[model samples]
Target chain A: MTISFTDAKSLNHDQLEEGTAFAPRFDAHGLITVVTLEDGSNDVLMVAHMNAETLSLTLESGIAHYWSRSRKAIWKKGETSGEMQEVIELRTDCDQDCLVMVVRQTGRGAACHTGRKSCFYRKVIMTDGTASLEDTGLPRLFDPEAVYGG
Target chain B: MTISFTDAKSLNHDQLEEGTAFAPRFDAHGLITVVTLEDGSNDVLMVAHMNAETLSLTLESGIAHYWSRSRKAIWKKGETSGEMQEVIELRTDCDQDCLVMVVRQTGRGAACHTGRKSCFYRKVIMTDGTASLEDTGLPRLFDPEAVYGG
Candidate 1:
């Protein structure tokens, strides 16, 4: 019973509107898990939150777009870094609350700003009666020090 | 718009009540996504699906259990294959319709039956008017013929 359960109660604040302008809205923790789908192998490139605009852009451009909560704007993967993710198919849960973006990676590195190949490059382990981070070996695919001159 | 948009819905037929003796039930499609917590990474390792018993044993043993829809029954990951997942945390959406099982992976291979490390081992792209898979080097850790034997 080490695992405690919590609910995404914030989602209760809003309701789904089904109309021409009815774009789905998610609370703080809602997300689109953009996955890299290559040859039947898949890995999560990065996770992004969706605003109506980004979702629309992704639907139109075939590239994943997300709302940066901190930047307060839309972020297209590999926009500045060139590590773009070209989405192949966008699937949603039966409820339409969450989205799964399966894409083909178009660049050398991951879609994260940190340069890691995947945002999920770390692993967690509950040992010694507590969970800790384990590096998954895939790290900053692009050499930032060589590029930025550390 | 070929796709129809709808509100979020969940299948809440099965409820676990400590040593509850019974068969678990879900709606037609059943539960199709599981949010597994990637231990150290704090990132989600992957999202998978389960029927009912897998969900049950997951709660029972603290080890990840999933009903392989493909195999069509209760399947304990890593039980025979040594690729088991250790459950650390569990969560649900506001409606309790979906389930999230955070786990620690025992990396003999992928949680996915596919040769790749994870089921999410591919990336896709739109080109020549068709979606193509992006080679993300998903099977870096595994050789299908090597582990599962051709």
Candidate 2:
């Protein structure tokens, strides 16, 4: 009894729009974009991609899992850092090429490998036609160097 | 002095982490992921992609612009629908491959082609090894057929 999704192209408009079918449309690469947000506050924690296996694991376990394109492996969030994300809600866009997961971040509450609360800790500033970045001053919740080592 | 970004590979730890340089890492297709969120509420409006030109325009004009992969064209969000998103803040992740935009949604406040307030209007439910979607019951702010024509 494992949860599963249907093929997006096979679904009719009613099923796609109003019905209960969960048909996700994966890109040619067999990956779908996943946006993770912190529960309650809804702050975007990170953006990643998920393959079918990782997606199913996330759904079955209520824990966040992502496909690591760079490593060519499946990533179980917080497996190494103890910063797991427990799914509060999972949603998909109109066509289902994208996913949104509202989760209760556990442990140190940092989502970025760099130890930031969120991956996006810097703002882009454009002034006088020149662009630069400014730190948002969000403190790091953990020491990545200590956790992952050099 | 037109704003420009450095090649992602050229950035060192300091340049990538703390420096003011804005070096975005575009994918092989020359696109970067952009996530839009409501300014005050932080509600995720939509997720899209941007090419270099669209990214520059977004920064220069303080308006959201995206690259439509399916259409093979640039998209000025809300151009025909009058749902322009004014950028209040633009953020980049640690490596700069992703962007998060805090925007003031203008016009009807609908960010989805389906006429919904946000692109994600349904929640996914998995019970007894079966997955389905449930409408969040968020009313349409406008009619798509009326706005874009049937």
Candidate 3:
């Protein structure tokens, strides 16, 4: 099958409307590329799924929204955690089957199942010095309980 | 373009080989879904990425392997943290785009950063009260320091 290509930097890319599942509209289908904010430390402070609606919401609101598996529903960032993710930029890969979201994580903590700061908590192993199972550093500056709860 | 459908229960359905990434292989592109495993406490010890290779490895070794993005390699579960994720059984969604990796987390703490056990450490907003972010009991499990030793 033949597929068309479009450059995200200069394209008709815009905020999708309500009820639009960005994942389906763009045909990105099943791939979500999460960008790490901190250069060396990959702390995930949010975990959002892109099906389309939330994708558009992210683009429009400049915030992150996701599909909560446990809740089996749509979720808006900072809706409860008070930790919102601001969109820095958005990019789609050459194949268009995936999307990359660059955002600045608000609040302090990982954006994953684990309460670290990034979704990439697990480190990768290689021939070189062992990679961090994940970037782990809660330097008081990122303790929500200390800041918010305390 | 039209897409072909396949049986997820079958072995040929987007399986992956377990190990960290060495180099991007043709089969690496087969990863279409992420399977999650959490014990009774809502503790997500680890999250495994399944391409075609690691999926097969899950069946063979009964452990988890995922595509290591940072290291540009493949990784086996507990290969580093010793908190290996033993495969219990694998389940796929209706569309076959993702899989539910029901696994038993054999570890000291969590499979995440911030030294918590499980990728999901806390729950943000439970809109419908359907999901509660069960605290895996605050404690350091896989000490990134002790293991990696920065």
DockQ winner: 2
The number of the candidate with the highest lDDT is 2
Q: Pairs clashing in candidate 2?
A: none
lDDT value, residue B91 of candidate 3: 42
DockQ for model 1? Answer: 0.04
Candidate 1 Cα lDDT to native: 0.51
Question: A6, model 1: CA deviation in Å?
Answer: 29
Regions more than 4 Å wrong, model 2? none
Locate the minimum summed-lDDT window of 10 residues in model 3 chain A: A15-24
lDDT of 2 by residue, A6-89 (tens): 987888876787667899888889999999999989899999999999999999899999999999999999999999999999
lDDT of 1 by residue, A1-150 (tens): 111112323233222211111223344455444333332344555544676557667766777778776688888867777777776665432223455576777778565445665544444334433333344566567865554454
Highest TM-score among the candidates is held by which one? 2
Residues B1-150 of candidate 1: C-alpha lDDT, one tens digit per residue:
111111133222222211111222243666535666566554344565676556655655678877665577677776655778888765432222344455788876466444445454333344443432334445545554566674
Root-mean-square deviation per candidate? 16.4, 1.4, 17.9
Estimated TM-score per prediction?
0.46, 0.96, 0.42
**Which residue segments of model 1 deviate by more than 4 Å?**
A1-25, A28-39, A145-150, B1-34, B37-150
| Candidate ordering by DockQ (highest first) | 2, 1, 3
Model 3, B59-107: lDDT tens per residue?
A: 5566777776546566786677687777665543222334445567776
Report how far residue A13 has shifted in candidate 1, in Å. Answer: 18
